[model samples]
Target: MKKLRNNTALLMMTLPGLLLLIAFHYLPIGGILIAFKDFSYSGGTFLKNFENSPWVGLKNFEFFINTPDAYIITRNTILYNLVFIVLGTAVAVALAIALKELRNQRSAKVYQTFILLPYFLSWIAVSYLFFGFLSADKGLINNLIMEPLGFHPIEWYSVKAYWPYILIFANLWKYAGYNCIVYLATITGIDPDYYEAASLDGATKWQQIRHITIPSISTVITLLVLLGIGRMFFADFGLFYQVPLNSGAVFEVTNVIDTYVFRALMNSGDIGMSAAASTFQAFVGFILVLLSNFIVRKIDKEKAIF
Candidate 1:
């Protein structure tokens, strides 16, 4: 009787969070069924009547696979994310190491706050800021750097060749600081006695970091890498869409799964096809996460997400 009462009381305390999860996350998941339907507005409301919306199981998937844009968007999405995962983590780790060396708390905090500020900015806002620097005519790069050096002002938006570098650099610049803070927290949580003992053993700075610091943080690093791998099949909508300013000229390089789906749905109103793309993405992401978890467990049992 006491256990039953405690369970009910615990349920009551958690009811609000459970309700929020159902309201926001699980309830909307049913909308995923639209991927397999030839949706139309004939139904006054989509949820009220899924019966009138005929199901065409595999057609949408077929169409998206056959799409010419499929190769480009998928490649771009995967490649960009891979670069972000590697370069972003590298930058973060480096920054975390540097921050760990700082004994002064105030200076460290100031630098950290400044670095993390960029992560809070919206993609659209960052896009405009980047435009101010890269704009062909009056951009800071052209007006202040290239033109001053008697070079041509390259049309950044119209140019596809430069976007990969731009995107990777932008991703690092915006998110590295935030990610480094996580790494720094992990680093700080390590026992100072490890470093002190290393010093007693005549360990140099590099040796201390190499043997003690890197190995200590390996678990967190592995966890973050696993999470990155899980999301490998997805793309950031704003990074691909807003950062390049949605210039059609740059679509060859910048087009990604999210933007491609948005275009297909909004422009062509192919709800079925767009839903298929989304479903495909979600399915792949799910499988990848499991596969990733398995791989992580094999490499380091302690680091696995499971």
Candidate 2:
């Protein structure tokens, strides 16, 4: 009781954010019932309609799980996320380390700003930017480079074989800069005395970095990787949809669970199926976080997120 009174101001400071969390996250959880319902708007209010809807238990799940495209969508979602997690971590850490080595502060800030600029761009804008380089007749790649080099212009959008690489590259380009900023902040917080001590002991730059820098940031890296594991079943909808201009030819490589659900929702207007898909995603994501945390705890309890 005494401690609670003493920390009253700090607890009060957290009240607004707590309320927002309840409003946005906790309150809406009741809508998960829609997953099992043949949901429709009949009259009164959303909650009332939700309540009155007839239950069709698990029928909605069949729309996604029993479809022929199920395997493809699931495979693409998992594979793309695995690649993103591995490559994104490597590139972000490498760039952060390289940026830290820059001697000139002004140039470093300028470079950081330029690198992070793409992160702020909407996927629609990035799609147009990509179109400038990929347009068959007038694109810079085709007209300037391919023609000058005596190669034929490729139909970039129609080629499913190339989209896997293209999407991976685009994902990295948009996100790596922002990801590196986190690592760079972690690196900056590291003590300079460790490096000085290593240098006095005749350690090279590489040795000092390997021994000090990476170890110091390992916790942040583990935390980020665990978070990424939780979202392994979700893809960035815009990256798969808008970036490819929604090309049907590249759907084999680009279509993911989110995109598949969106297209299904658009065509059929099946609210129950869409809700079911979302519920499934949330359940799988929750399980994944728990499993990953369990493994991490077994390997190194200190690094486990829980």
Candidate 3:
């Protein structure tokens, strides 16, 4: 009776949020079936009137597989995400360790706040800020620095070659501090007695970090990596789209599945096809998550997300 009362109370408190989630997230899942059907606005909400709309099961998937750009977009998505996962984690881990060494807690928190500020800024805003530095015509980079050094002011937008480095740098700047805070939290949770013992053994700071900090946080790092790997098929839409500003020349390096889907939806206005693309992304992400967690379980069962 006590457990049932507690459960009922919990349900009462959670009902509103549950309804909101259903309205926003789970309720929309029905649209995923549109990918398999010839969904039409004229056909009403459930997409009736198939005789007019028509069904093309597996055709969209086939279309994507046969397209030459499939390999390219797939490659770009995987490569960019892989790099972000590896480098982002490493850099964040390092910063977290370094910050933990600071004696003044308030000063450390202030520095953390400053570092995390950029993450709250929109990517579109970042794009314009970057324009001031890289814009070919009147950029400060050209007038003040590159020109002073007698180098030509390269047209950054028109050039596809530079986007790889540009994307990596942008990602690092925006996410490194945010990610570091997670590792920092894990680091702070460690028992101080371990560190005290290491110090008593005359361990240097670097040695202590290498021997203690990294090893202690390895489980958290592994869990994070597994979570990241699950979303390997996904890409940040703004980071890929707004950052490049739809430059046709740079599409080779910047185009990913999400951007391609956006372009198709905007141009074709084909709800079914767009749904198919989105469903594809969700499916890939789902499978990757399971696969990654399985691998984690194999290596270290305790660290697996499941």
Tens digits of per-residue lDDT for model 3, 162-269: 999999999999999999999999999999998999999999998899999999999999988877887787898989998888898999999998898788778877
Judge candidate 3 against the unseen true structure and give its global Cα lDDT, from 0 to 1: 0.87
The global C-alpha lDDT for each of the candidates, from Candidate 1 onward, is 0.89, 0.94, 0.87
Which sections of candidate 2 miss by over 4 Å?
1-20, 42-44
lDDT of 1: 0.89
* TM-scores for candidates 1 onward, in order: 0.92, 0.94, 0.91
Ranking by TM-score: 2, 1, 3
Can you rank all candidates by lDDT, best first? 2, 1, 3
The TM-score, computed over Cα atoms with residue i paired to residue i, of candidate 1 is 0.92
Model 3 Cα shift for residue 215 (angstroms): 1.9
* lDDT (10s digit) by residue, model 1, range 134-229: 988889999999988999889999989999999888899899999998899999999999999999999999999899999999999988987887
Stretches of model 3 off by over 4 angstroms after superposition: 1-24, 42-52
